[model samples]
Target chain A: MDSLAEELIQIKREGAAAVLATVTGADENGGVEPGQKCLVRDGKIRAGSIRDWALLQAILKEAEARLKEERSKLVPFDIPGTQGKAEVFFEVLPSPPKLIVVGAGHIAVPLVKMAKILDYHVTVLDDRLQFANRERFPDADEILVGDMAETLKGISITPWTYIVLITRGHKYDEPCLREIIHGPAKYIGMIGSRRRIKACFQRFRDEEKIAEEVIQRVHAPIGLDIRTETPEEIALSILAETIKVRRGGAAQSLSGKQ
Target chain B: MDTIYDQVKEFLDKGETVAVATIVSTKGSTPREVGAKMVVTAWGEILGTIGGGCGEADVRREAIEVIRTRKPRTVRVDLLDDISSDSPAVCGGIMNVFIDPWWKEKEG
Candidate 1:
């Protein structure tokens, strides 16, 4: 394979977010040609055929925005010195979203399984090895056994990460929430009853002085209003909520509301 | 990890010219979103799918031509004509797919 193709495969396998910008149309004498491409990863041009320095910089800036939104589109770029315009298609390859299930309980087993089915990089964590073993979470990418909140410190929390706080109790869930409440996780969900969740948020607001907006970001009493009963159903509901958040869906039923 | 690029890489490394067909833009009610891709080999074998039915078959025919000629072309697939038919590609939408030729010599 060519070096650029090989590099693209490596970037995808490593689950890195990158953008492939291809020039699809160019005005005559534009100094760019159709089918030319540049691969941008981590704000650097790792490979491709585009050569103009000015165009590369412009493409890099636009590529960053596309990667951030995780959307791909055909964009137009005007040449630096002329009326020539180059139409570039920016294709965003987002990394697999990480689903960290923080409590290897009954719900977690099904949650990990469902998340794996959805192609998430699933990680299961617990304070007890007996609960967080390979037997319970065979498909999980990482089975971590440690103090849940402390272990969270070791994991890199990016905007692609989703944290599901389903620990044994709110005593455990709250501390874990504190560890990541200010971090960059795209979704933070905690399992608890309405009353308990209210008390927990009150504590976070009054004692910890956590900002109200940050505290409100947590999806307490997590999952959609699906009236789920079984463990598998609950897992499905939680994942459905996560998917809604990820895809920006309307979260409405197809059957219509009567 | 299962990108059409992976399949394209495999074909190019074997010294074969492959046609990479991508759904660059889509209208309404299509089966798949834009950026959906499929790789067509010189022997007319497909690695992925850009929806199915007549739209794919039409693209496959054009993809074969793209492989033979080593030239990229855009195909406009209209599903509105088959809306009353039983074809699965009849989603009442139109999409423009760009079929590009990729080989070992082509960089980026």
Candidate 2:
């Protein structure tokens, strides 16, 4: 691999966001040529051979907008003070989606394993060091042992983060849910029985006065109703629900009997 | 394990240039969504797929040409016309594929 390719692999491994700009077309006298490229990370040009002073400045400015939206596109740019009309394709490489599993109990063991299989940046946390150790979660990216709510408050949550609350009981899960309920997580699912979830939402709605829409966002009684019995089956259902939420799928039966 | 970049890196490590064809944008009902990619080696071997059928074949031809010239170009693939083809990939949509050549020389 070349230095650029090596850096790209490292960037992906670290799950860093970046934009790769490639000039696909340009006028001859425009001082920019096709196939010229530049790599942008953290609002600066990190690599690539696009060395034109004006073109680099233009690309840096446009790359920021592309990275902000996390959308790749074929964009046309007309450089200032030059007759350079070029079409550059900005490819946004967003960070991988993260999975934060709170309360490393029985369900969490299989949940963490499945999330890792789905290529999530899995973080398993619990109050008990015995439960939240590497012995059980060998594939977890982070094994956090601390107060569940406090740990959740300390950790950074992004739109790509998926939080699962499968604590020992409602008392443990409630505080953890409160910490991340208003945050920017993409999906927030709490494991509990329907009656327990209803009482919890009632407390949030009446006592705390949390909005109905806000409480509605929490996927309590989490997981698709596939009549899950075992921990592994429940874990699979939860992951399937998260996938449905993330990818906008209609949860129809795929029994394939038809 | 199915990362196209990893395969591209492997080909580059072997001193063989390859073309990375990416569907940058699509209109109507294409088989694959935008950002679907296929890596075409200089020997016309493909790693991933941007949807199979006549459209992919056209892109493969252009990808090899991109590798030979070591230049990047965008090929507009029209899947609207070929509805009678045997391949199930025809979805009556138009997709713009950007074929970019990758090699060791482009690096710093």
Candidate 3:
């Protein structure tokens, strides 16, 4: 077998998501020993010390679920063909989340900055060259200048992608939202007022015939209800809401709950 | 960006063993989250950190032994005793660190 260290180095170099399952403990049956490992990537066993085909299949299934959730956990697995269990730790190594800011406006400035600090692979797209440039967004991983909605169609939207529509007007934002609403993006948030959002959703229902659950996936008025008063504060609230969604947090104050 | 694994690859290429210490689990208010890792050389050189301070020091000591013996072990790090101490790692929590020896033969 190839070196596990080499496999890990490759995973990091490729910026790909993978799971490292290690046997931490085993029952008296001695079916497995501690430190036995398997490297799972893209739903396949890339390499490792695990020799049991049945155990490898089980690890692959669990690794896929863990990668989707983007969490590392320790789980006990029943060793097939044996009367014992193996305690395995699934260490999830995920690539950085991609954030596509569909507008290079005021909120995009702070939003891109905050997302950079949070280690997101941020891309800022705008139709206006002046609004989307290196001068304004030095921290953004990618500064794209093109039609916002049309440009979104060219980008690959995966489950690890987050789309934030903060265009200058609904005419721009709505189209961008429509482009990604039914795509694979994990989070799609559009900036608008309550009345405007309601109208937009009505249009989706009446004109587009979009499902309610599909419309619900979008965070229309984008951000947590933190009574944000400034652009920076709004950016913070949006990122907070995004984190809440990513980590599955309640988004409620720990001290008091409603 | 010199990742921890990149450094581990360097040592493994030299046919040397290094100990990787990872916080597999934690209880209470630990300084770092689970899966935080640090690499330690056989000569006691350290790369990265697992919430430095007394808990880290203890893990470092055990890590060297793991490298020497080529064995893997788990150590429970307790920070409840030094709650009032000035150490920044005194997060009033406990964590279990799994130290595993990695060489050229083993996958990183």
Residue-by-residue lDDT tens digits, candidate 1, A164-184:
999999889999999999999
Q: Pick the candidate with the highest DockQ.
A: 1
Distance from true location, Cα of B12 in model 3, Å: 0.9
Instruction: Tell me how each candidate scores on DockQ against the true complex.
Output: 0.60, 0.42, 0.49
| Residue A229 local lDDT, model 3 | 92
Cα lDDT of all candidates, in order? 0.87, 0.85, 0.86
**DockQ of predicted candidate 1:** 0.60
Clashing pairs in 1: none
What local lDDT does model 2 show for residue A27?
Answer: 88
Give candidate 2 misplaced runs (Cα > 4 Å): A28-30, A51-69, A81-84, A104-110, A128-146, A153-156, A181-184, A191-258
Model 2 chain A lowest lDDT segment of ten: A249-258
lDDT of model 2 at residue A182? 95
Q: Alpha carbon lDDT of residue B103, candidate 2?
A: 90
- Candidate 1 CAPRI classification by DockQ: medium
RMSD of each: 2.9, 5.1, 2.6
Give the alpha carbon lDDT tens digit for every residue of A1-258 in model 3: 127777787887777889999887787774777788999988888888888888888889999999999988878889888888987888999977899998899989999999999999999999999999999999999999998888988998888898888999999989888888999888888888888988999999999999998998888778888888999998998888778878888874211221
Runs of candidate 1 exceeding 4 Å displacement: A252-258
**Which structure is stronger by DockQ: 1 or 2?**
1
lDDT of 3 at A16: 83
Model 3: lDDT of residue B4: 84
